[model samples]
Target: MEKEGLQRSVEFFKHHNINIKTLVTDRHVQIKKWVRENMEDTTHAFDVWHVAKGMKKKLFALSKEKDCSDVSPWIKSMVNHMYWTAASSANLNEDLILAKWQSISNHIINIHDGHSTLFPSCQHDDLEGRERHKKWLKPGSKVYEKLQDIVNSRQMKKDIPMLSSGQQTSELEGFHSVVNHFAPKMIGFSFHGMLSR
Candidate 1:
């Protein structure tokens, strides 16, 4: 089913003379692998929200750990950091993306300054004045380690580049909700029901 949808989309674009430079989607296992093997001409990026969602699930699970109980509360902030990491590294390569992402361990410690491979020190300005309500976590703490593990995982690394800087599926999801209002999934549609929709 996923392959058929992809093939149909490719055919539709080709028929309409639309040159697809990139394809952004949630990290569906089959689709991700299929696109990598088949769509060499197009860059595949995973949706930032989906990547964050995956991280949230991991963090939630980790929060149950004996030393990692504190991680549960910080899940929301960590998800926001995922978006921040993606947005800040716009027009940059995967290495920069990884560097910025890895720097979060420093950022959470109220150490906005960092040492990444691409940048010797933190690139952003000092957050001294604006950074109120700061929640600092030690780098070597179990919660921090769990958070880092989730952020630095192999799947997150692979999907970092395609994290959307401009386009987002939030609006698309909203549109689907509206469509469902018109053509709800629960009811079986007759000819007139379909037309009404």
Candidate 2:
């Protein structure tokens, strides 16, 4: 149904002679492939919020795994880092964006330097006493290993570069909320009925 909506939207835009230069949507695999094949001229980007939501779910699950409980305390900060990376990344430089995203692994261990040549060092005031109190992950420990895997996962490496840098779907989601208030998903309506609603 989502793909159908995208197809209809594209057709409508094409009918009106408006070329879409960039498109942003959640990381829907089918839609991604469709855009790749059908809208080759368009730059399709994944919504950062959606990607971050998915990442948080994984982090939450990992937080429960034995030897991974240390991650529980940092989930919110990590997600915020993703949002910051997506929004603050300059130009469309994928490498720089990725370098920033991957820097968190070091940051978690309180080693905020030498992440990548592109980013080099974390941009932060020197921590006065914070590092001394927290239980930072040891490099070879299970939690750190799992965190490194999560941060450098193949999917993250690919999607990190493709995150939408401008214009989020939050407004669209707000519109959907209004629509759902009128036409709740649990109750089905006919095509014309849905339109009227």
Candidate with top lDDT is 2
Instruction: Give the lDDT of residue 163 in candidate 2.
Output: 91
Q: Tens digit of lDDT per residue, candidate 2, span 1-197? A: 99999999999999999999999999999999999999989999889899999999999989999988988878888988998898897465888899999999998888988888899998877766744566677889998898889999999999999998887888999999999999999999999999999
What tens digits encode model 1's per-residue C-alpha lDDT throughout 34-54?
888888898777778888887
Clashes of each: 1, 0
lDDT, model 2, position 103: 94
TM-score of 1: 0.82
For each candidate, the alpha-carbon lDDT, in order, equals 0.76, 0.90
Off by over 4 Å in 2: 128-134
Q: Of the candidates shown, which would achieve the greatest TM-score relative to the real structure?
A: 2
Worst 10 residues of 1 by lDDT: 126-135
Query: What are the candidates' C-alpha RMSDs?
Result: 2.7, 1.8
